[model samples]
Target chain A: MGIAREHDLHKRRFSRNRGVGLALAAFVAIIFGLTVVKVSNMDVVGSYAAGSLTAGGDK
Target chain B: MSDTSARTTPPPAIGGEGDFADYFALLKPRVMSLVVFTALVGLLVAPVPAHPMIALAAILFIAIGGGAAGALNMWWDADIDAMMQRTKARPIPAGRVAPGEALAIGVALSGMSVVMLGLAANWVAAGLLAFTIFFYAVVYTMWLKRRTPQNIVIGGAAGAFPPMIGWAVATGGVSPESLLMFLIVFVWTPPHFWALALFVRSDYEHAGVPMLTVTHGRRATRAHILAYTLLLAPVTIGAGLTSVGGPVYLMVAVALNLWLIWGALNIRRRSEETATADGYRAEKAFFRFSIFYLFLHFGALLAEAALRPYGLGGW
Candidate 1:
C-alpha cells in the first residue's frame, strides 16, 4: 500500500502552527532583550534596594 | 465501542479548526490596545526614566497580562456572550475556540507574564500586574458582572490599574500622578459604557447582565452618564496640577471636558423617543467623543512629558 504524503488535518493546522512558532520566537527575543537590559543596569537594582531600605529606616 | 464503529465515527469538530486569529480573538485585542496605550502613557510620564528596552518589555508583559484576563473572561462569559449580539462572535461563543483552551491559555499567560515582569522590572510592578489580572478575571468577571447594575462602575478598577502598574515599573511604587491617571480611567468607564449600553440597549437585557441601562431605564442611565461626566471633569482638570500635568494637559482638559459636558448634556436632555427616532445619534456621538476625550487627555500628558526637556511640555 502507498503511504500518503500529508493529511487534511496538517493542511488545516498550518496557520495555527505558524502563529505559535512566531509567538515562541518573539518570546525568546523579548527574554533575551530583557536579560541584556537588566544586566547592563546593575545600579538600578542596587538603588531600588537602597531606596527601600531608607524608606524602611524612616518608617 | 468497537474499533470499526470508532473508525467510522467522525472526529468532533467543535473546536477542531481554530485558526491563530481565533485564539488571538480570545485575548480581546481592542481592550488590550487601550491597556497598552494607557500603560505606555503611564510609563512615559513617570518622574523616573526607564531604559527603552526595559520600558518595552514592561509594556509587553503588562499587555499580555491584560489579554490573559480577557481570555479568562471570554471563557467564563461564553454562555452570555453567545446570547448577546456584540459578543456572540467571540471565539468561544462562535465555537472557533474551546472554553477549556481559552482558560488554559489565560492561566498560562497570566503566570508567565507576571513572572517575566518581575524578572524584567521590579517585583512591585510584577505584583501589580498579577493583582490586575486577578481583579479582572476573578473579582470583576466572576463576582460582580452578573450581580449588579453597578458592575462596570466597580469593575472599572481592573482596567484602571494598568497605568499604575506602568508607573510602578519606573518608580517602584505608586504616586499621586499614577493615582490620578487611575482615577481618570475609573471614573470614565461608567459613562463610556453607559453610552454604549444606551445604544445597544437590549444586548445586556437579553443576556441577563444588569447593566444600568437595562436595570434603571434609559433616562436614568442618561442621568448617570451626565453625573459621571460632571464628576470626571474635576478629577481630570485637577490632574493638571499633579507632576504629570502641564499647561498643555490643562488646556486640553478644559477644552475636552467642555465638549464632554456638552455631549453629556445633550444625552441627558433627549428623551428616549427622540433618541429612538434619531437612532441614538446623540448617544453614539457622545460615545465616539468619549474615546477621543480619554485619548487626548492621555496624549496631552505625553506631550507634557515630551516637552519637559525643551521646557515647553509642562509647568
Candidate 2:
C-alpha cells in the first residue's frame, strides 16, 4: 500500500510539471503565431529597407 | 513515475550548465516587457499607421534587441550582481549560466536583432535599435555604471530610445511628439531610480556601484529627486500639447506627476534615522508609485491612440 501511494504521488508531481511546461510552450507559440499571421495579411512587394543588396537584388 | 523520480534526483548543478528557464531569465523578460509595451504605444500613437504584420515584426525585433542588451548587461554585471543580495539570485550570479555563454548569446542576438529588423522595417528603426543596444551594453554598462552617480541620468537614454524607435518604425522618422515621449522618460528615470536608491543604498554600496544615494548621501539624493520631479512635471504636462496626447493623457500626467512630486517632497524632509524607524515606508511607497506612474502614463497614451479612431483623442 505504501509503495502504491508513493507511485501515485510521483505520477501527480510529473503531471503537474508537465502541465506547467506545456502552458509555457503554448503561451509562446500562440504569441508567435498571432504575430506572423497578422503580418502575413499585408502584401510585401520588395525590400524598402535601408541599403541596397548585391548583384541580383539585395546585399 | 517512481523510476523517473529516482532518475531526476541528480547531484546539484555545478558550473551552472543552465536550463531553458535560466536562458530565458538571462533575457530579462520583465524589462523586455516594459520595452515592448512602450514601443507598442509609440508605434500606435505615431501619425502614420503600419500594417499589422509590419507592426508585429518591428516590435519583435525591438523586443529581441532589448533582450539582447539585457543579456549583455547580465554578463557584464555578474560580478556586482553576485555581491548584492538583490541580484544574487540572477542566473549568472546564482551560477545557473556561464559568463562566456551569456556573452555569446548577447552578441549573436544583438547582430540578429539589428540585421533582421533592418530587413523587416526601415533602416531608421533598425539603426535606433542598434544604437539602443550599443548604448546600453557599452556606454551604460561598461563605462558609466561603475564610474558616476549620474549613471542613471545619462544611461536613461538607452531605455528612453525604444519609443523613438517604435515611432520611427511607423513614420520612418521622428516628430515633435516622439521627442516629447523620449524626454518624459529621460526626466522621469532619475527620480524613479533615486527613490529606490534611498531604500536600497546599502545594496549598491556593498556591490561597489556608485548610485546617487551611495555617492552623494541621502540628503543630496533626496534633493535631486525633488529637483527632477519639478522638471518632470512640466514635461509630462507638455506632452499633452503634442499630437500623441489627449484628454486622457493630460489628466493622467497632471494627477500622477503631482503625486510623485509630493512623494519626493515627503522623502526630502525625512531623516535617515526616521526613515529606518519607519522602515523606509515613504520611500518605498514612492518607488512603487513611480512604477505605477510610468505605466499609467504610457497606458494613457495607448488609450488616446485607441480613441483617435473614435474622434475622442488629440487636440
Candidate 3:
C-alpha cells in the first residue's frame, strides 16, 4: 500500500509539471507567430519614402 | 519521464565561448529592429543627404546602442525574470550568462556605439543615443520598473527615442516631423503594453512587479487601455498629415485606429470570467493586433516617403 501511494503521488506531480511546461511552450509559440506575421506584413519600402518626405518638409 | 532522468545540466556561465550570436542576443534584436527602421526613415526623409556609408554607420551604431540597453535591462531584471514564466528562460535567468558579465557588455557597447556615432555622424545623434541608453537602463530599469504601476507609461519614453535619434543623425537637430513620430509611439506604448499586462497579471504578481493590473486591478487596467486607445487615434492620424505622411498613410491610419478602437471597446465590456471563458482569447487577439498596428503605421510612413518624388504626398 505504501509503495502504491508513493507511485500515485509521483504520477500526479509529473502530470502537473507537464501541464505547466505545455502551457509555457504554447505561449512562446503564439508570441513567435505574432512576430513573424507582423514582420512579413511590414511595408518597409513605403516607410522609407514617408520618412524621407517628413525630413524634407522640415527644411 | 525517462528523459528527465537522462538530462544533464550544463555548467553555469554568463556567456560561453564568447560567440557572436550570444553577444547579438544580448542586444534585444526585436527592439533593435525597430530602432534601425525608424533611424533609416529619419535618414531617408531628412532634407540633407547623408553619404550611404555614413548612414550605414549611424544606423549600425544606433542599433548597438539599443542592444546595450537591452543587456543592461536583462542584468538588472534577472532576479524578477527568474520568477516569471515568460522571462525565466532568458540568458541571465537561465544561468547561461552572469548578471555582472551582462552589465559589462552593456556598458562597453553603450560607450562604443555613442562614440562611433559621434565620429561617423554628428554629436547630436550621439547625444540622443547616449540619453536613450541612460533613460532605458538607468531611469526605466533601475528607478521606475519595480517602484511604480506607471512604469511602462514613463519607461515607454526610452523606446520612443529611436526615430528622434535617427532624425538627429541626418539633420543634427530635432524637427516637428520627428516629434510627431515620437508622439505617436509614446501614446501607443501604454495601451499596447497594458493589454499584455492584463493577461499576464499573475506573472507580474508572482514576480512582485507593480504593473497596473497588480496595483489598480483588472477593471482599472481595462479602463486605462480604452482611454489610451482613444487618445492614440488622433496622434496616429495626425502623423499622416505631417510632411512625412500622405494619403496612403492617412487611409491606413484611419482603418487601423478604427480596428484598435473596436478591440479596446470590446476589452472594456468583457468581464474577467467572460474573458477566462474564452480562454482569455479576445485579449490575446488584441495584444497580437496591437503589435501589427504600430508596425503598419510606421510602415505606412515609409510608404509615404516612397511616393513623395512624384509630388503625390504631403502630411
lDDT winner among the candidates?
1
Ranking by TM-score: 1, 2, 3
Q: Write the per-residue lDDT of candidate 1 for residues B117-140, one digit (tens) a residue.
A: 998889999999999999999999
User: Which residue segments of model 1 deviate by more than 4 Å?
Assistant: A1-12, A43-59, B1-13
Question: Worst ten-residue run, lDDT, model 3 chain B?
Answer: B14-23
Ranking by DockQ: 1, 2, 3
lDDT of each: 0.93, 0.86, 0.84
Interface RMSD of 1: 1.6
Segments in model 2 whose C-alpha atoms lie over 4 Å from true places = A1-59, B1-16
Could you give candidate 2's per-residue lDDT for residues A15-57 as a string of tens digits?
5467559856954664576557545544242343322343346
Per-model TM values vs. the true structure = 0.91, 0.83, 0.79
Tens-digit lDDT string for candidate 3 (B227-252): 99999999989888878888999999
lDDT of 3 at B256: 96
Tens-digit lDDT string for candidate 3 (A1-59)? 67656564465456546655774595456445545544544667668879999999999
Clashing pairs in 2: A39-B53, A53-A58, A53-A59, A54-A58, A54-A59
- Local error of candidate 3 at residue A7 (angstroms): 37
Q: Is the docking of candidate 1 incorrect, acceptable, medium or high quality?
A: medium
List model 2 lDDT by residue over B70-154, tens digit each. 9999999999998999899998878777788899989988998888678767899999999999999999999999999999999
lDDT of 1 at B71: 96
TM-score of chain B only, all predictions? 0.96, 0.94, 0.93
For model 1, the TM-score of its B chain against the native B chain is: 0.96
